[model samples]
Target: MRLQVKKWNLSNHSDYEKQCGQYCYKIVKTLLNFLKFLKNENDNFNSIIEGKDRQIAELQAKLTSLYSNEHKPNEFDSLRKLITESNTAVINELRSQFLDFHNNGEIKPPYDSLKRCQNESTEYNTKVNESKGGETYIESPYPNSCVPFGNSSKQYKINVAGAGSFHVLCDAHTAGPGWITILRRADGKVDFDRDWNAYRNGFGSLNGDFFIGLEKLHYITKSQPYELYVHLKQLNGQTIHARYGEFAISNEKEKYNLIKLDLYSGTAGDYLKTSKHTGFSTKNKVNIQYAKKFNGGWWFNDYTKSNLNGKYVADNNLVGMFWGDLKILNLVKMLIRPKV
Candidate 1:
C-alpha cells in the first residue's frame, strides 16, 4: 500500500538540537567531577601504602633486636671461653720457652733457679696473706735498677723521697777484697764517700771494678732515681765482699736524693775513714782504712767528717736513694719543700 509521506519540520528540529546540547553538557560536567574524585582517591591510596611500609620497617627492626638479644648470651659465653683458653695457652707457651732457654744454656741455671725460687716464695707469701685475711705488702724493687732476674745488662736506679731504709741486691761473676761505699746527696750535688779514696788515689787498685759514673746514674734516675751498685775486686784474692743493703738520708731540702754504693775488695779492712781539719783550713778528707778482723771487711766510717754539701755524689752506694716509698701526704710535703 502507498503510505502518506511525512515532511521534516523546522520547529521539531530546533527542539531536538536543544535537547541534544543539554545532554552533552550534562555528560561533560559528570566526567570532570568524576576525574576530580579519582585524583583524591589516588592521593589517599599512596598515603596508606607509605604508612603500611613504615609500619613494616619498624616491626622488622624490633624483631631483629629481639633476635640479637636472644642469641647474645651464647655468643658472649663462647667468646669469653675462647679468650680464657688463649690466655692459658700463651702462659703455658711462655713457661715452656723459659724452660727451653735454661736447657739450652743461654742463661745460667743458678739465676734461673733463683728466679723460680723467688716466684714460688712470692706465691707462698701471697697464699699466706690470703689465708690471714690480709693483703700482702709487695714491695717493688728499686726503680730502674738492673735486677738480677732479668736478661738485660741495663741497671736500675731508684730515688727515695724521704729518709728511709732500703735493701738492694746485686749479682756479679767475680768476688774479691773490696769495699762498698754508700753516699748521699748533701747539697743537691753528688759526691763519693771518702772510702773511695783508696781506689781513686791508687793506693789499692780495682782490677775488675765496673765503674758507672754519675751521668749514667742521672739517666737512670731521670725516670727513676738511684745508681747501680758497682762490684769492685782487687788483684789479690785476699778478700770477698757482696754489699747489698739500704742507706738513709735526712731531709735537708726534702728533694729526692741520689746516692751511689760501691762494692770494692782488695786489702784487709780497707774501709772508708774521714779526717777533719778543725782550725785553719776547715777542710775534711775521706780515707780508706784496713780492717784486720774481716780481711776485706770495710767499715763505713768517716761519714760525719765529709762535707755535707747539699748535693749528691756519683759513686755513693746507697740503695733506695733515688726512689722511696712514702705516703701520699709525705710525697706532697717533700715536693713542696724549699730548695737548699
Candidate 2:
C-alpha cells in the first residue's frame, strides 16, 4: 500500500513540474513581445526627433543666412526700397530704364517691364527656402486689374500699369465678378475726413475701410475704359447700386478731376452726374462751396448731392453717407471694372 501511494505522489509531482514549465514559457513569450513593442516605439520616437532636428537645423541655417553680412539684396528688394522711399528722381530713372529696355526689345513694353519687375519682386519676397516638404510658393502678382483672378472674390495683389503693385479686393460674386473695389466704407474704423495728401495717397485697411488712393485711381482708370459701380447699403439692410458706363478722373496736376460720368443707370438717382467736370475735394482742398461743410472727400457739386465719404452716422442725416435724398448708409463701396 505504501509503494502504491509513493508512485501516485511521484506522478502528481511530475505533472506539476510540466504545468509550471508551460506557464513560465508563456510569461517569457509575453515579455519578449512587450520588449519588441517598446523597441518599435523607441525607434519611431527617435525618427520623429531626428526629423524635427533636421527642420530646426534648416531653419537655423536660413536665419543665419538672412542675417549674414555676405547676404545680398536682389532686384526685388531694390525696387521695393525705391518705391517705399518715394524718391521721384529714382522712380523716373527706373521708368526710363524700363523704357530703354522696351525700346531695345529686351522687354515687351514699359507696362510689361514694370509688371514683370513687380511680379518678380512679389515672388522673391514671398518665397521661403526650406525643406522640400516645407517649401511654399505664392502665386505671382496679377498683371492687370481684376481680370486675372477671374470670378474669384478675394483680395489679390495687382500690379497696376505705371502705378506699382498693391492689393485690391476683387468683387467676383457680386454683379458678375471682376470688379476692383477702389473704396469701401464699413465699420467706420478709418478716418475718411483726411487731408489732400491722405486722400491722394490713400489710407485705411483693405480688410475694413479703405480708399485705393487718387493717384492709383487716375492710373487705373486712364489705363482703360472702366465702368463704375457704386454700392450702398441702408441701415435696414436694403441695398442699391449706381453703375456708370463711363467713369474716369484726371491726374494730380488736374486735381484729379471727375472727367466723365456719362451713361449712369441704377436704383440710386443720378446726383453725381451734376458733379461731372468737377475736381475732387477734401476738407483742406475745398474746390466747391460745400466741401468743407460736408466734412469728407468727394467730387462735390455746387450743392450737396451725395457724399459717400462723409461722416458715418446711424440716422437719415444729410451729413452721413447719403446719395441725394437717400438715408444714411450702413455701408458704401465704390468699385470699377474694365468695360466688357
Candidate 3:
C-alpha cells in the first residue's frame, strides 16, 4: 500500500510539471505577438512623421522662392514695360516716315526717288518684260485669302488701242467688302526692288496705289501696239492677292475719245457704285473720273473737260477710273462718247 501511494504521488508531480510548461509556452507566445504589434505601430508612426516632414520641407522651399527678388512681380513689370516702350518707338518711327497725300500737299523735288513717284507723273523710266498676247505673269506677295478670277482654260484677246485713253469695267458683284483698282504701270518690266519709280504714282511719291496722274495711263497718244499691263490691286491696303492680267495695248482708230469697257458677260450690272458699305446703281455708267497730274492725283468727276470734280463720271465706270469689287470677266470694249 505504501508503494502504491508513492507511485500515485510521482504521477501527480509529473502531470503538474507538464501543465506548468504548457502555461509558460502559451504566455511566451502571447508576449511575442504583443511585441510584433508594437513594432508595426512604431514603423507606421515613423512613416507618417517622415511624410509630414517632407511636406513641411516643400512649404519652406516655396516660401523661400516667394521671397526671392528674382521671381518678384516687379521683374515681370520691367519686361512688360520694355515691350510697351518698343511698340511706342516703332509707332513714332512710322509716324515720322509715313507720308500721305492728304497731309503732304504739293511739293517740289529733292525727295527720295521712291517717294518722288507718288506725285510726279512723268517719272516712269523703266520698261517691262514683254508678255506674249499681252498676258502679264504675276506672283503674289501676301499670305492671305484673295478672291480669285476663275481659271481661264484659254486666254482671250482684248485689244486696247495704244492711242487715246483706255477704260476697263468689272461688272461682277463681290460678296465681301473689298475695293479694287487698275494699277497703270508704264513699263511692262516690273522690278519691285530697283524700278521704284516705275511703281510710283504720278508726281513720284511713296504711295504706289490710289494714284491717278501721269504715271497712270491717263492720257495717251497714238503709237505702235504697246504691251500695256492691266493689274488689279486692292485699295483697302489689305494684304490680299492682287489680281493681275495683261492685254495687248496696240494702236487703234481714234473714232471716239473715250472707250467704255464692259464685261463681255451679262455680269456688267453686278458692279455698281458703293458708298458707306451700300451698293448703288450707275444706270449703265460708272463714275469715271480723271485724276490730274497737277492736282496730285485728285479725282475730277465733272463730265466737262474743264471741271475736274466730275459730274458724269459714274455715267461710265466700265472702262474708266473707280474703285470696284468685281471680277474682270469677259472683256467687251463698248466705246461711249462723253456728252458735251
Scored against the true structure, residue 273 in model 2 reaches a CA lDDT of 84
Q: Per-residue CA lDDT of candidate 3, range 1-340, in tens?
A: 3554322233687876776675567898888997786577546545544553464354345434433433422233333343344434433433343333225532232234323222221111110111212333121232111112222211111222221232222212321221122332222222211111322222221222122222233222121111121222323322222111211111112211222222222322212111112111122212222322111122123422211111211224333323333322211111111111
CA deviation > 4 Å runs, candidate 3: 1-20, 70-340
How well does candidate 3 match the true structure in TM-score terms?
0.18
**Candidate 2's residue-wise lDDT over 1-340, tens digit each?**
3554322223687876776675567898888997786577546545544553464355445544554433322322333343333333333455775466557635543454345445443433344322112444232355568887888989988876557688888998657778999988889888788789999999888889999899999988876789999998888899888999999999999999999788989997887887888889987885644656776788876764888888888865446677888857888999999998
Q: Say which candidate scores most in lDDT.
A: 2
Name the candidate, 1 or 2, with the larger lDDT value: 2
lDDT of 1 by residue, 1-340 (tens): 9997644344787876776675567897888897786577546545544553464354345434534453322232333334344434434544564455567635332344334434543443343223221333233444323333343322234332221123222232222211122222223222222222322222211122222322222233333222222222222323222222322221113211224223323332222222111110111221223221111112223332222211232333422121112101100000000011
User: Which has the greatest TM-score?
Assistant: 2
The C-alpha RMSD of each candidate to the native structure, in angstroms, is 30.1, 21.9, 30.4
lDDT of each model, Cα atoms only? 0.30, 0.72, 0.27
Candidate 3 worst ten-residue window by lDDT:
121-130
What's the lDDT of the predicted structure labeled candidate 2?
A: 0.72
Please give the distance, in angstroms, between residue 103's alpha carbon in candidate 3 and its true position after superposition: 92
Worst 10 residues of 1 by lDDT: 330-339
Error of 2 at 120 (Å): 24
